[model samples]
Target chain A: MKIALDTIRHSLEGAIPGVVATCDANGIPNVSYVSQVHYVDSNQVALSFQFFNKTRGNMLANPQLTAYLIDPETAARYRLALLYLRTETDGPLFQNMKAKLAGIASHTGMAGVFELRGADVCRVLDIERVPGAEAPRALPPYNWLTVLRALGQRVAGCGDMAGLFEEVLGGLEEMLDIRHSLLLMWDECGHKLYTVASRGYVHSGIGSEIPLGCGVIGVAAQYQTPIRITHMAAEYSYSKAVRENAGLDPQRLETAIPFPGLAEPHSQMALPLLASGKLLGVLYVESAQDMRFGFEDEDGLSVLAQQIALNLVQLQQAGDVETDTAAVAVGASPAGARLQIRFYPANHSVFIGDDYLIKGVAGAILWRLLHYYVHENRTEFSNRELRLDKHLNLPDIDDNLEARLILLQRRLAEKSSALAIVKTGRGRFRLQVNQPVQLLEHEVGAAL
Target chain B: MIGSSAGIPTPMSTTAPSPPVLRPEDADFIRSGVSVCVASRDVRHVPSLARGLGCAVCDGGRTLRLLLVKSQSEALLRDLEKSGQIAVVFTRPSTHRSLQIKGSDARLETASSGDEQLVQTSFEAFADDLLTIGFSRAFTGLYYQHEKSDLVAVTFTPDDVFLQTPGPNAGARLEPLP
Candidate 1:
């Protein structure tokens, strides 16, 4: 069977450097090693225009070129006859190529030298297998379609936002074989993304934030497009982004929260979870091995992201269930250490003693949960009750209530405080306080 | 024949000034475990390329001889026969230091007695270089494999040498050799 150009798109990531050949008008041919042959579409690809060399000169004169690409998986080779189209210095394509080039440059020890001047788009005129080359070996045993089908079913069965979050992360690990992954929520006003859930890390990194356009995850959220990097670049590394942003405003940066990521990741893929043109957040995954996540993984995650966005919107719109008005008798406060909960109204930052817990929606959710537990003596809570609570000012139907609950639970656990929230049943939880709690509200401008 | 050829622009008219000879240091860099590729174009200006097995620089760094697998050189050889012009690139994978040498007069010949050993040594060195960078030996060996009977040599006199390294001076012509 003849393979289409798009079928082998993953092989174009430049793991095995591609050879691009172009001829001058006089017929003298120039061949140069290309770091990447970016797949633009079925019939088009883009090459990085880093230098004004013989290959570039030949393309300008002849407009005809050929590129030899190798399939890293199967070691099969293909020849593409390409016609130079145009050069783009800016926009999504340029940014995508620029980010990818940074990774390649760093991987090859040419960090400062390999800058992308432009993205030279070309029309793939034809694609043919190199005659007499070995046939492509069998692909890996995993079938994406089967995995996607099972994941869709699991996602559909999720009863609430928390369940959905768990299912999504679980499916990525079990169904897709991805171990290290994170789910972050977009903070529109803050201009950052905060981690709500994570897997395969020592710390869950809940509430850790990455500023928009900071790294691979940030770039994906900024453009609302999927960004994949085969080789990790220091320019886009999370640690570097943290250090660079730390000098800025403390309020604007989440410096107190450490971002959880691999110390040295060779491959990373970030996809924006967008619904109806609104950027919800980003789904990120990384691996220590190079080229671990290919186009197939990207496509699979893309489909999952779309479904996740839709479900989130639907659940948010469903709103909270009607509140139960009957007041319940509160049990006497347990005898233990006194826990003081201080709430800063300015940024909605909540602190238990001297340690900062969370801010924003998650913070608001904690404040609300504790408020009910103290005043109403409400030991039990459900998803619907919180959704209907007006004081929380939960964002539209897109509000990730379950994710916030998980964040609250993890944060409380990490602090090992006397106050804890444990799951008793679906969409319901029990607030366990082993000590007497004093709640205090303070103005933002007031001294600590 | 240099500038009077129809349809082909004079190579020296570009911003880059042609070098007089290949520098000794540059020749040594090329002969090292550098990645090599050769290219030529057909009458319609469509280009063809092939991996170069190894290369030898002689005659005081004036003559360059490139070895290629014959089975993979069909299109490249055809282009050479038509135009007698070729451009070859030698890039050190580790450092990304690269050079492009173009020749107006190129000829293809059978591999000589010592050419096989030279190609073998070059391949072994290249494989070792790749190993240090995390590529498995078996993989590198398969990539560099070529039947001795299927090897052919293309010799050319370097006429234009351009710095192809990734940097601000990339594509700039080197100083003219005395």
Candidate 2:
């Protein structure tokens, strides 16, 4: 049945972050968030989706479908029916979608600034009134990483609290588009900031020590409040010791921010890591772009950090799983305690020492990150490439990848002595392990 | 050269050992020479041709013709036939170097019907390594009038094709693809 234009408009207005789904000939489905939907005619509407999505693939394969728009808060639903028609440059439908999109892009302040490409045209046939489907099941409130930690609790238990901390650190990096993310745990006895887990800048001798409230990272430790700085002048006002610390070079940190070659602008955010109302550590994310973090980012990161705190507390309560498992497996001798390594031609993982071996797509992603530890390479690769490498070609990784890494990092900490490795960052495929071990080992029997 | 001597008229002093004359555009596609004699074109569905041989019908001498593909897809041929799209299929078998295939009504998927065997066989025979397939809009300057026009040229390289016959005729030259 034909739905009226006014009704469609009302339905769309309530559906913030509308979702569009498309399928390829191979039956692969893709879904992404779209901004606003514009009605071209009574029988047609157009919407702009996040660039480089699977919906385009589906539209090319089978053009008939409907879009689901939902209310994020109340979880209400709206459906817009559409018929994606394959058209050339001169097709009337193609021109219509483009014209409608131009207005929306301009209203969003994008206009011609961002590289906005148009996909094949599809006529929006009708708006349907479908009852709201369940909001993509509210991701279990228990942080996935925390859940994995609990599952592994009985099997391996949380061994490396330090490693668990780093896994959580990585999750924070991903949620927020911050380069050079670091988690500095507060030492109650020493009253100092120590780099427990870090990504981005290299750790020289000086970064290892900072008195509480002496620097930007340290002040967050002291105050237990989240802080953000748009410029270094603001950072200097926070802590005089931070202004002089060898690690606090605003110019160099600017160069090291993710997305190399864009070093003109700068932004920074620092958040406290507290579990049970006790300061566990501080997370710092820096960007070379101004106004980089928006309300969505702030909210997402706050939730992510809170989840990390829960995981850290659970790890502490479980006691060190890695040490207990390792003492039985390896003798007190240093050689016996040395972390054992194994490599697989394709994908490989094993339960060694305290950490579980995560190979294949998990292995590739983890390996790429740890490799970054040796020499900080923050080249942003596409999600497709990262997923293909990790063999997890599902649309999203920011959630699943972190869950897996959290398990891996905690397990590795249990198995090995080095507690400072395995940090995560904003980019896809990142791993930071304290031990600089070569992933590929030479077999003595095969070589001369 | 299984059935070449019977159906096709051979030129004087032509032998299977002699190299076949190739159209200029198709020469690069036949560096190693023809390997099999599948059908040039097929009008009716005929299965089990000589147990392993392939067959198709071509209107003899069709040079390249420009067409447009409305939808870019894995089933490219099917998408081409979906209307408002353009492409060229062969009409009959002929031995002319400069062939013309202007406005010829042709059928696609005559042999395989639904299977992609002909496309597979054609790719294997034409280029052993299966380099590239000819699609619409290759010779755009000559064919397309407006930038928005959906037109592409389909160039067929017949050098890798053998006429099913007793022997090859040296004077049998292929028409140039676009």
Tell me, by TM-score, which candidate is best. 1
How accurate locally, in lDDT, is each candidate? 0.80, 0.38
Give per-candidate clash totals: 2, 47
Q: Residue A77 in candidate 1 has what lDDT?
A: 69
lDDT of 1 by residue, A1-448 (tens): 6668887775787777788998776666677888879998888999999887877988888899889887765656688889999999987788788888888888888788788999999999888776433434677658999998999998888766667778999889997778999999887767788898889999889889899888889889988888888787888899887677654456656667789989888888899999999998899999998778877888889999999888877766553543443445568878877789999877778899878998877788888878888888887877777777788777665366766787788888988568888886656777887788889999778664
For candidate 2, the per-residue lDDT at B170 reads: 18
lDDT of 2: 0.38
Cα lDDT tens digits for candidate 2, A363-406:
44545544443344332232334444434343331223333344
Per-residue lDDT, model 2, residue B160, is: 25
TM-score of chain A of 1: 0.89
Candidate 1 TM-score over all chains jointly: 0.87
Task: Compute the lDDT for candidate 1.
Answer: 0.80
Once model 1 is optimally superposed onto the true structure by TM-score, how far is the C-alpha of residue A201 displaced, in angstroms?
2.1
